[model samples]
Target: MRRSRDVPLLVERARAGDPRAVARLITLVESGDDLLPQVAAALAPYAGQAQVVGLTGSPGVGKSTTTNELVRALRSRGHRVGVLAIDPSSPFTGGAILGDRVRMQDHATDPGVYIRSMSSRGHLGGLSAATPQAVRVLEGAGCDVVLVETVGVGQAEVEVASLADTTLVLLAPGMGDAIQAVKAGILEIADVFVVNKADRDGADATVRDIQGNIALSERGPGEWRPQVVRTVAARGEGIDDLAAALDKHRGWLVEHDELRRRREARAAAEVEAIALGALRARIGSLRDGTELPALAARVAGGSLDPYAAAAELLAQLGA
Candidate 1:
């Protein structure tokens, strides 16, 4: 049951620029539910209003710093921005922030910028399950731009790209073994490859490596040729150009009907996510879930086979 009877009111107030209402709305979305119809209806009016950017990279690659600079850059352009920084520590209890505060630094107090830290929350699918919902909430709140920063959880890559309008894979210069560092999935879907810390050694090589990676990434006719942008976020270098690249891509997408395609794709993925999440939830609700523990005990005693148990669960779900 939803703990908030005033969710709709909160949603309305948030849209009216009420910061407290916005904060409360963030909490509601951060803790997601199977209420997709409500979520979709609430989000219909704001669709196409926010450009969601997913910023992900290896740990210590300054993804947070780059994201902060990007947010500042966008804000200077008079755009409202919302950030949901996904941290790895929340995977267990859905409450970890890792270095979000340390990374975001000073943006928390900005009224135009809303930033929230999310934990991985032990999701089986890698990215936080509530992440997509958070995106919708931010969009509904009228942010012109929204950023989702992943937990840097290795190469699981998860489904961030599927939820975002654009995905940026940030790489720092001199973070060596360039040839062996490209992650697939989300990395392959990058609309912009950012070589941050571009003033550092090996920056040139990193740029080349990223360019090569983009060359290998999927491309369609004039496929919005993904650009390899070099930025020294610490010094605010290339910030405007990167922003320009983002705009250029957006314009190209709008020109080619790819923007609509991407949103349709996201909507499809959202449906799939809801179906899968519901299936998992239903299985979890079976017999109060004691079926799993008892079955595990039986397997431990060698009285049953784990594979067979899984088959039974699938059969129960009509899979």
Candidate 2:
């Protein structure tokens, strides 16, 4: 229920690094508030200012732990960081089932860091529907880097590839994730393969398995190859190697001009989603009007073919 007039002030405060303003703006985005369009417009100028990195993997792979360490690593280099942890929602109450803040207490008192956990609310693709807009909010809040941590759902989480400038797919030893990576099509989306928990038994075997798969894949000349980094995130071991891998990938993205291409594609997808949602809303409104019912009646009576009736309905809706 945010007012449209307040959007400008919110955006101004967010640009000045006000955490509460950033939180309020993200809440509006998540709730689909009536003034969301105004909020988006106010924040549009700051789009693409932050480096968005997505971390996703199956449950128990230590995504949150890795993210916590990664934030510390990034902050060490003086980067203002924002984290959006998408947690699975409770089936009954529709609230976040896991609280990420409990695990990332080190940065709770840091003014340069902002962390917010969003419930997936049964949304598919391991992310909340408002994730892209929420990223925009973080960018507008002057964060140099934004981390998007998925809900850790298997297979369906590949959608993160479309949103992230660089996508990190985490796997651990003894989980058979190296084999699952192929079956789940994770090999195609991973820019960096972080074999976390490197201290575990069979860790080398898992790394070898992923390297073997990477060797078998075909790539065009100058295409970026995924880098594999091992880490024991629980003890903050090998985090520097992980950070180096991320920086290397970022350099490649810039050198190849892939960053602009990826951002353009992300913007195109966001625009299309908004357009489709508006169309669906308009069609829903027509459900209570005469056009849809008349069309349905004609089709049910077999007096008009469904294709033609649909065309007429679209025409009536000025679509």
Candidate 3:
């Protein structure tokens, strides 16, 4: 645990581009340290400063490769970038299973970029529960862009839309992703669709599938339509087009004033999660006390109904 007094200094160092300080702050966020309140307080002022882009797709869709090329493209335009790659957790160790981040080794020595692979730790939404706080840490450290790459858990990955200002759904030929997108409700969440591995066979068909789906969806006047860009990520092909699409979407977000609304919703969800966690902790504490057990006994013995017993428990905790 870090001393609460050190939080301000750490935040200051991070803002000055001290990678070690930034790393420490993210570690604190991931671990849910006792001083997290102080860290969040210190970082609150920098909220919503970075362009948070989330990249998600199936496991074999070249998400990492696309992210790497996108990072390079963004850096070419001189943007300070941060990447949070959420990898599946090792069941035994509860650590990031793909911690090496082999595809992103090209930027390891680039001080202009910060990359961190976080364990999803059994989190169901393809993201770690701590991701939002970690993103705040990166924003406080002066990153102009933060790319959140999800664990690619398919159907449950729509949660990324809540955290990102722009969500890119990557697809590859023969992956059936175009069809799966409809069934998984991904069509509603995607801001841009990237048909990666565009040099492969069936690439054109995949693009057409997505385009056809987009045409079928109804939209209100002036609503932003999703764009599709094809890319051969391995060869660094069409990356500029993808970047252009992202910038265009960002401009639209600003023009339509959707960015502020999205950030406000993100903040509200974070607060609600924290409040629910505190409530759960209070309930857990009552297990060691008499309130919960007494309530359980009454409910089990038919002396009190379950809903009334729950109400009594909440009342006892002053909830």
Tens digit per residue, CA lDDT, model 2, 53-118: 999876678888999999999999999999998776746322323544578878988989999988
Residue-level lDDT tens digits of model 3 in 238-284: 99999999999999999999988888898899899999988998989
In candidate 1, stretches whose alpha carbon ends up further than 4 angstroms from where it belongs are 1-5, 33-40, 90-97, 124-126, 155-158, 184-187, 215-220, 289-319
Query: Which scores better on TM-score, 1 or 2?
Result: 2
Clashing residue pairs found in predicted model 2: none
RMSD of 1: 3.9
lDDT of 1 by residue, 1-319 (tens): 3644556676788788787876666666666654445755676677778888878777667777788899999999999999987766534523334554666766877788888776666664356777777777777778899988874455434467777777777778767643375555645667888888988899998888777766776677776677888899888889898899888887877888988998998888878877987888888876577777777788899999999988877777788
Q: On a 0 to 1 TM-score scale, where does candidate 3 land against the true structure?
A: 0.94
| lDDT top scorer | 3
Model 2, C-alpha of 279: deviation from truth (Å):
1.0
Ranking by TM-score: 3, 2, 1
Candidate 1 steric clashes: 3
In candidate 1, the residue pairs with backbone N, CA or C atoms under 3 Å apart (3 or more residues apart, or in different chains) clash, namely 90-121, 91-121, 91-122
Supply the global lDDT for candidate 3. Answer: 0.87
Using lDDT as the measure, name the better of candidate 1 and candidate 3: 3
